[model samples]
Target: MNDADKKRLLREMIFYRRFEDRTFEAYMERKIGGFLHLYSGQEAVATGVLEKAVVGQGNKNDYVITGYRDHVHALKTGAPAKEVMAELYGKETGSSRGRGGSMHIFDPTQNFMGGYALVGQPFPLAAGLAMGCKHKKTNQIAICFLGDGANNQGTFHETMNMAKIWNLPVLFVCENNGYAIGTHIDRSTAVRDQYKRVAAYDMEASQHDGMDIDIVMEAAEKAIDFVRSGKGPYFLEFMTYRFRGHSMSDAKSYRTREEELEWEKRDPINIYSKRLIDAGLITQDDIKAMEREIDENMENEIIKFAEESPEPRVEDLTKYVLDDNPDPRWIGPLQK
Candidate 1:
């Protein structure tokens, strides 16, 4: 990457961090309800990984599916920030038409399939997407983002075996943030180093530092290249840490303050920005200006868009439920 590209990525990561930070505030103020997972410290994983996938195969349209910490993934896939924020507010103009919030940010135009709320749900679905791309000979691939805790789900193993047998064009990227909703990987899962978990299925896998965007980009390029070659599936485990609790509701009581601060030292946004600054590509004032711009955009535009957007109507409660079929059985009869 050129000096300019590095600087651009640094700002983008900062924007993502601030975006999530703003969402945290919104959730606290009761604007965003339901399961709110912030992708604060793990910005590099999605930003770096998808950076290659977007341009891969001549931008032939790759598919993305991840677990509920998906705001960044959706944004990186070209979903507008306003639409995402509106979804969090459950507004009429939100993505998924205000039906699926936070955990289910779906933008099919960009081929970001959706974020699944179920543990390991995206696993098999990702393989299915890859299978379709292979069958259609579109040269497209499916990128599945998963959490470390999700590796224990049965779907992980099943999909890994199936992807290898069929040689599906899918790349599974695991964000090992050391915990499964307060349960550390060591307590509940075997093989703390998540990359090795795929070895049982004889799939290609590796681990890296998710705190560094450039490192993730380099690793992702190699992995995407191998998968796009139709050699089957590749699993990448990025050792990362989440600055916030698993969800908004989580107090993070399971971990100590010392451990949290230790991981905070390796914050991805700080690491990347520091590198750019040290390289003489950017200055602290430039970073502050970028932050100011982001703050203004979020406050004046993104948040305003969501707050001003109308909520989904009660009469149309069942509207997007099932192809506009209006199934009273599902939502239990709309208002009389």
Candidate 2:
């Protein structure tokens, strides 16, 4: 890649890392409520994949959806940091108007479908979106992000079958962070290599180092290109780790401190920063400047926006709860 592209990627990765760190701090301070999931150690996966999937020329029509650990993805997919932070703060100015909380951020303008809380729900939803694009004869594709544990869901296999048979344009990304909540991948999954499972449906599939942004970008570009060319679905397994617990409340007793430290040694941001400096693409001063900029934005801009934003009023609680005009047949007894 060119120096410009490398610098752009580095800047974005750093922004996401800093943003996540600040978010965790906010959660700890009880500024943001509900279950909080931090995308701390797995920055490279989202940064690399999204750099190709959602940005630049020829990517305007793409759609993105992911599992609940979604703050970083929402931001990278073009949702403003202020709006995302507001969403976490349960402010009415949030992406979902404070209704979805941390997990269910949606911004249709950016074509970020949502951050679904259900384990593997995004799989079929992504396939449906792809099918819509196919029927409309648009080159648009859907990128579905799921966790390693979600791979075990029945919806995963069902979506794979439907996507292959119908030749839907979709990319199924499994961010395998080793553990699913308290359970490890070895114990939860029958086949350790998640990508190999895609072979059952005869779809294109591969694995890549999720810790390296460049490798992920390379793999993602190939997979996205194949899918956009109307070659059906592609499966990508990103082997990564989460530095924090599954959620803010997790004790993480299942893993050892040694294992955690070992992965920390391979910190994606530190490694990529070192690589950039060594290659003369960026200097220490450049890194420091970027860090300072991100910190200022988080403190002066994003947090203040959220804190000053209004909360949804109780009287208007049912406003966005249901559709304004729905088919009477589809409306259940509860609505009636």
Candidate 3:
């Protein structure tokens, strides 16, 4: 990578970290609601993989789908930060036009597909997308992002089998953060390492350190190349950790502070920032300036956009509903 790319990635990682932090504050202040999952520590996985997937693949977009922890993925896949923030605020200017808050961030024009609220939902949806591409003979592939717990879902195994049988061009990424909503993987998952589980389907797979952007990039470059080369599906497990609890409501009493602190030492933003500084690509002052700029943008642009955006009007609530042939019983009567 060039000096410029390194510096840009460093800035992006820092921006993502601050973005999640600000999101936590917004949730606390009641500016946002619903199941708020912050991508605080897992920035590198999304940053590295999404950025690398499009590199040298020309300007075409690869379809991306993920679970509820999706703000960062959406942003990386070309969803604007202001629109994401507005989505969280449930305003009319949101990516989903205020219909789906936090969980369902859909922007298909950018090929980000959508984030699913149901556990393991994206697994089959991604495979189906790949199947469509294969039928159409398009070079485009589907990228599926799911959590460690999601690996146990029946869809995970089902999709793996079908992808291999049909030779679908899909990449399944398991963000193994060591816990399934406070339950450690060791306790719930019999096979701890997620990549090893894909062997049941004879699929190619690997694991990598998700905290380091460079490592994640190197791993994703190979996986994405193999999948896009028409070699069928590839599975990658990123051993990452989320800094916050599963959701805004989670107290996280299940984990120890000592363990959290240990993971904090490997914080993705800090690691990337230090790497950029040590390589002389950027100075500590430059990093601070980057943070200041991001913070200001979050407050001035993103927050202002969400705050100033109009709330969805009550009369417009049924606009997107299936009213073309609506059932009278399900629809009932609207309030006057």
Q: What is the lDDT of every predicted structure here?
A: 0.90, 0.89, 0.89
TM-score of each: 0.94, 0.94, 0.94
Worst 10 residues of 2 by lDDT: 52-61
Q: lDDT, candidate 2, residue 106?
A: 88
Task: Provide the clashing-pair count of each candidate structure.
Answer: 0, 0, 0
Q: Which pairs of residues collide in candidate 1?
A: none
Error of 1 at 210 (Å): 0.8
lDDT of 2 by residue, 1-336 (tens): 788988888888888888888888999899999998889889999888888875433246488899899988888888888999999999999999999988999888888889988888999999998998889887888988888999888999999999999999999989999988889999998888999999999999999899988899899999999999988899999999999999999999999999999999988998899999999888999899999988998899999999999999999888865787787787755753
Runs in model 2 with CA error above 4 Å? 56-59, 325-336
Decoy 3 TM-score against native: 0.94
Over 4 Å off, model 1 = 55-59, 325-336
